[model samples]
Target: MTTPSAEPRPRFAADAMLGRLARWLRTLGFDTAYDPAVHDPELVALAAAEGRVLLTRDRHLVAHLRPERAGLITDDAPLDQLRQVVAACALAPPPALFSRCPVCNAQLRPATEDEAATLVPAASRALPGPVSRCPGCARVYWEGSHTRRMRQALSRALPGWIS
Candidate 1:
């Protein structure tokens, strides 16, 4: 049997049930579209229109889509769901961690120290590190304890993927 050629990592559109998984995928630098308000049919259409893989837990929905363009997520637990998607897609570690906004799904831009100081809480401003800001949500990000913890968790989940 011929091994399937590894495809370029796909962009994704996650159904409402996979919100957490979408955020994690975004955190890992994948372009994932997730809107809880988007109905299944619209999601399928959006995925098709945007050339995104549809990641869903609905068996019926998966059945309707081309198998090569969709993945059925079976796990209920968020972490397990994440692992399932990663494995299904053969995803690699993000080229840049925190490249996308977890809340709004927008790409993050580097924030100047002054901009970060103005946007972030005093505690976060006191930390010495570069920061990124989401242009859509205006949320500031820094390498604080929370980011460190998330990095640790991602490293554990993906193994040799996060640095």
Candidate 2:
């Protein structure tokens, strides 16, 4: 096994059951890996290989792994799960919204006007704001109602962390 880094930004791999938690983490700009097809052993191995802290609701799996590397989430609610994770890992919210693609877990990049014109929907294009695109999936993102809601949720979850 490889030694974990001391200065590593917290990375995570969530088990199949924690899909919502995984997406929320990605929304917070965390590098979270989630795939329903991954079984427990493979998921644990992947987390170990990638230097990630494994997040799961499976107590059995957690019992099988080193305590330092795995976190078993007890809460059923997504917000509670998020709170548990933040408290457990001592996480700080991302500095910017839409910094990562919630779907593919890829970092988002600024979309050029031309790119936005071609890629963004007509309704979104008409809105006055900057847009970003995911290089992995080419999905366009903007500060729309959904973004505002997510930001609000994060702010509430980690008060004074997100501006």
Candidate 3:
């Protein structure tokens, strides 16, 4: 399969209705901005200031945005919405799965062995793969069965998007 574009991929902001979609985007390492309580005006402004494509289910919100600055979500399911956004935005596959913090939308860094010792659960540290940490929220990440399940979800939802 072909990658998205030569230019940098656009970041995103999802409306409150698309919280799940936002998290999924972050799962694929996209810098997505989402706030469950943000108002339409504020969300629009945030997208504009940050050069983000606003993904929303609200037609009224779509009306206020320039066509390029908005994506109208037409599906109820998160995975379907994800497919639509991925196509509309011409997104590329992520450099690494779980490279971004799904909770805070921050890029995750590889955790030092010392940091992992303190932050990661002993059970998880023993599982395999390196640990990662989100600087924004201090949440730690490690490859575990959950990560494998998430990867499988991605593989099913988006064929050939993740390896």
Candidate 4:
């Protein structure tokens, strides 16, 4: 296995059962694209086309593929699944903050309150500080309790990660 620094951080495409894992990957700042009802062949094809590593739970789906982009998810639970992917991909360190949108798997850009004002929800606008904006989905983000829970959960699942 390649060391963390030596391994290239791969983009990802996750299968149906691994949605939680995909979301967690996005939280960890990986570019993870997830879709439900995607056939194995389609998943593999998407991975190839987009140059993303396929993340899945099915043994057969994970094993038979010849794509340079693939990793078999080893855990059934969300937290464990997240840990498995992180370790398997050798992405032990946290990636740059706000690099990805947690909801739609789009790339996020740093935006000021004025720049992101339209995208920002009224509740969010009235609420707080700087916001991150997803250019593809036009989703606005501000770190909150949900993000904190995700961070804490990830901290527990992957020790020494982002350290």
Clashes of each: 0, 0, 0, 0
Q: Per-residue lDDT tens digits of candidate 3, residues 80-106?
A: 898888787778788778889999999
Better of 1 and 2 by TM-score: 1
Name model 2 segments beyond 4 Å from true: 1-5, 65-68
Each candidate: RMSD: 2.8, 2.9, 2.9, 3.0
Cα lDDT for residue 74, candidate 2: 93
Best by lDDT: 3
163 in model 3: Cα distance from truth in Å?
1.4
Tens digits of per-residue lDDT, candidate 4, 1-163, equal 1223544676788988888888888877888888797888888899889877788778887667765667777778988887777666667576555578877888788777586667666666665545787888877777666656766776788876643
**lDDT measured at residue 60 in model 3 versus the true structure, 0 to 100:** 82
Q: Candidate 3's error at 40, in angstroms? A: 0.4
All candidates' lDDT scores?
Answer: 0.83, 0.83, 0.85, 0.75
> Which residue pairs in candidate 4 collide?
none
Worst 10 residues of 1 by lDDT: 1-10
Which stretches of model 1 miss by more than 4 angstroms? 1-7, 65-68
lDDT per residue as tens, model 2, 116-147: 88888887788767899999998989877888
Runs with alpha carbons beyond 4 Å of true place in candidate 4: 1-7, 64-66, 115-129
Q: Which scores better on lDDT, 1 or 3? A: 3
Query: Rank order by TM-score, top first?
Result: 3, 1, 2, 4
